[model samples]
Target: MDLSYTERERAFRDELREWLAANPPGERPQGEEADYAWRRDWQRRLHEGGWAGVHWPVEYGGRGASLMETAIFFEELGRARAPLPANVLGLLLGGPTLMVWGTEEQKDRYLPPILSAQEIWCQGFSEPDAGSDLAALKTRARRDGDGWVVSGQKVWTSGAQFSKWCMLVARTDPDVPKHKGLTYFLMDMEQEAVQVRPLVQITGEADFNELFVEEARIPDENVIGGVGNGWKVALTTLMNERAGLGFFLQVRLRQLLDELVEQAAASGALDDPRVADRLGDLHVRTEILRLTAYRGLSAIEQYGQPGPEGSLVKWLWSDTNQMLTQLAADVVGPEALTAGRPWAYELLRARGNSIEGGTTEILKNIVAERVLGLPRAR
Candidate 1:
């Protein structure tokens, strides 16, 4: 596959780089509220500069960038150390899913707000009982007049507290099979029926939340694609989550590895053969992850769908990130373990990387069954 950027692509990159240099993000504020506000303001700047929603179609107030250009946008943003826009869930997951499955009016009403960060979004798919096996989710929704009433608990919903809307999937019919009975809805998070509580992590940061819904109201028009079509629509969101976010994540992994390398070199730890060997191995893996992600992008551009490399890249990234963070503990020594330090927090956060999105075990299953054409795992 031709991996080199063409002249037009290089121009696109140059244009983006120039814009970023001129409009670099300000220093992040101290508290979570302030930091989120900072990111939201940055998204506003991006929107004003016509840089938001680079992957969205032009008709939907996006740049209509090609897949490669979109990848470049995320990579550059990560390299610049810019925080992802506040409505990342909306821009990456909600907007794309709606574009595919939303009615015309839905797109008109929702797409612009997401691009401009006027509204934040969160996901409500993973329940207490259902993590990887999403179809087995027990969140229930029942018909109520012209809308639906939903009740369930969703865990690990990042940015739930700040979100105005949720990409919710609930079982609407228990009589049918689990997968077939589900429906996708954009549930309003501002209502009294919804409660969001912070789920504190080992790092003492509440980057995620638990969503408790008690008869939350969702209009019939809010149903995406249609009732009993939630699985397909949800798949759209899931695929976008895996494929679109990889660019930023892979670049962040590279940046972290670079920091570790600098730390190792500063301490003369790189002189040790074992240390040098491991460092070299991590560097190689980081590049491989970046390359595999590009290869997946190429496949999507050429074939209209992502290749198996999507799963492999995430698996590689999570393992490599965990390895990189562990190496930091060796190179940075005590400071890496001290509370509140960057490396220390990273070490703890890296622990969940393998389990989030899709666990390593689950990814292996997808690779084996879909990519390798092997038998399904029971």
Candidate 2:
């Protein structure tokens, strides 16, 4: 497949770059809340500029652009070094899931706010015990008169403390197999029964949280697909999550490569053959990942779904991130050991790349058995 951009695509990219330059994010305050507010305002600006929901249908406040256009938007966002939109969960996961599996009423109610960044959204997938084993989540959503009474805990819920809504998964059938007994709901975060306690990371930041639900009410209309068909609905969301994660990994790796090149040259480390080889390896890995993402984008444009190839992209991204960060630390030496440096924080954060969204071990299992038709390890 020729991954060359057409003249029209190049023009589109230029237009996006110009718009971003005109409305760049001014110096944001250092606090998390301030940064979040800045991101939200930036998202609104994108909406007003008619560049917010490039992938959604035109009737739903989006440009109805192709998958390549969506890819272009992300690439441009990275180029600008802008903070991610505060409503990324809604834009990437919730919006696409609703578009595919949500009811018309649900779409009408949720899609517009997501495009405008009116509501920040979070994912309530991981529980205290269900981080890697997602199908084993224990959150329960019991039937109430006109709604469901959601009661359980979700851990490592990123951005839940600031979100207005959450895409939640809960157990609705105890007798069935783990994957078959679940339900998905759109939950209100401000309800009296919902509690969010911050989870502090090694970066000395509370970017994730543990969510406690005590008889939280989820209206019947808030269900995404159906009662017990949540596993299918969740797959839709997970597929989108995998794709978004891959995009982030590529952008981050590019940033790391740029930094590494600068550091190596400044430190005269480029003269070392090992350092040179590592840099070359990272460059090749990043290019391969970029080509894989483009392939996924092409598939989405043609077939309307990225399919199982997304798992390959996810695995490659996670593993490459972990590997590249290790190389960065090695090259930076004592600077990487320092606490406040970006590479140090990045090295610590890379530990989660193998664990977040889905673990590298789990992703490898998926690619081996499901994608490659290999025998199960167990």
Candidate 3:
């Protein structure tokens, strides 16, 4: 596939690059609330500039960008070091999935706020009992008079405290098979039945939360796709979880590696032959990742889906990011681990890279069974 950008695509990139250069994001604040507010404002600015929903259908106030241009948007956002928009879950996963499964009325009601960042969204798919094996989730939603009453616990939910809605999946019918008995709901987060408790990670941030949903009431109109078809609807959200975000994270890895190289050169760490060799290896791997990702993007656009041949680059990007951060500690020494420093925070945060999104072991099993076409164990 030709990796070269067309003239129009190049113009798109240049325009965004210029805008970002002129309006760089200010230094993030100290507290979580402050940081979140800053990101929300940044997203507002992106929307005003006609850049936030570049790929959403134009009829829904998007630019209607092609798939490649959408990829360019995330890559440029990452290269600019701008934090993702605070309504990211809504923009990337929620809105897109709604477009796929929601009725016309649902789209009209939800898509506008999503583009404007008026309503933040969070995903409530991963229960404490079902992280990797989502099908094993026990969250239950029983039918009510004109709606449903849901009760469960969801862990590792980001932005729940700030969200107005949740893309929630619950067991609507336990009699049928686990996957078939599920239903998707656009749950209102402002209800008293919902609670969000922050979880502080090693990075000294509470970016994730535990959601205790106790008898939350959702109207039948909030039902997405249909009852008993949530497994399929949720699949749409899961597929989008990594699409553009993979490109952003890969660019972040590349940026961190570049910084490491510059720091090493400045401090004369390059004198060590072993250190130099390792850096070279990392650089090669970064380039390979970039190439493979673009190739995967091409495959995804040409075909409706990225086939088995197209590797899930997020898995590799996660591994590489951890390694890159560790190397920074070695090369930069004690100073790298000094609290409050960018390198220090990055090193701490990298610890969860392998576990978050999906674990390496589980991802390996998926590849073995799905991509390699290996038989599952009896």
Candidate 4:
């Protein structure tokens, strides 16, 4: 199969590149507050330029672009070194889930705000005891009149404090099997009983939080799919998550490696064969990831969604990110011991790539069973 972009695709890439050059992001901000403001403004600019919601249908305030075009957009954004839109949950997961399963009124109400950056969203999927084993989540949502009352805790909820809403999953029936009794809802974060407590990371930043829901009420209309079909609704969002992989990772890895190479050369560490070999390995791995991402994009263009092959890309990316950060620490030597240094912070942050979204072990099992058709380990 031919892997080259068409003439129109090349023109599209050039157009995005020119737009980004004219509207580059300003200086990096210090805290989450500034970061959110910067990203919101950036997203608004993209929306105004007709660059946001490239994958959504035209009826929903998008450009009605094909999957290849969407991939081209991501590629150009990475090439421009642009920061991802701050409301990633909305663009990547929530919007798509709403598109597929939400009622017409829900989609009409939510998708426009998401595209415009007027509403930020967070994912409330992971619970205290349900990280990789998502089906084991214990958060409860019981029916109450025309709405559901939610009462439970969600841990590691990224960007919860600033979000206006959450794409939440909760167990509606405990007696049934783990996957069969859950429901998904679009939760409003402004309710009286909902509380967000920041969880500080090793970098001394609190991007993630623990959400406490004490009788948080969601209207029945907030349900994404039919009752007791949350697992299926969640799969839709998870599929979107898996499909959007490699863009951020590719951007981050490229920037970090460039900085590491410069630092190593200036510090005379590049002369070491061990360091050189490690950097070479990282470069090769990154190239493979790039190609894998392109192939996945190709599949999405042809099939309207990516296949399970995305698991390979996700697994490789998490492992490579960890390895490269460790190599950076080695190159920095004693400087790595300094807390809050870029290299040290990067190493600490890399720890989460393996665990977040889905754990490495879980992803491996997916590839083994789904891709390789391997038998269960019993």
For this target, which candidate reaches the highest TM-score against the unseen true structure? 1
Error (Å) of candidate 1 at residue 151 is 1.0
How many clashing pairs does model 2 include? 0
Better of 2 and 3 by TM-score: 3
lDDT of model 1 at residue 296?
82
Shift in Å, residue 228, candidate 3: 0.8
User: If scored against the real structure, what TM-score would every candidate get?
Assistant: 0.98, 0.94, 0.97, 0.96
lDDT of candidates 1 onward, in order: 0.92, 0.85, 0.89, 0.86
lDDT of 3 by residue, 60-173 (tens): 888899878888999998988899999999999999999999999999999999988999999999988898889988989999999999999998999999999999999999
Model 1, span 1-378: residue lDDT tens: 566898888998999999999999978789999999999999999999999999899999999999899989999999888999999999999999999999999999999999999999999999999999999999999999999999999999999999999999999999998999999999999999999999999789999999999989999999999999999999999988865678899889988888888888989999999999999999999999888888888888899887878669889999999999998898888878987899998999999999999999999999999999999789
lDDT of 2 by residue, 66-159 (tens): 6787778787787678777888889889999999998889998998998898888999998888877889999999998999999999988888
TM-score of 4: 0.96
After TM-score superposition, the amount by which residue 35's alpha carbon in candidate 3 deviates from its true location, in angstroms, is 0.9
lDDT, residue 367, model 2: 83
Q: How does residue 317 of candidate 2 score in lDDT? A: 74
RMSD of each: 1.1, 1.8, 1.3, 1.6
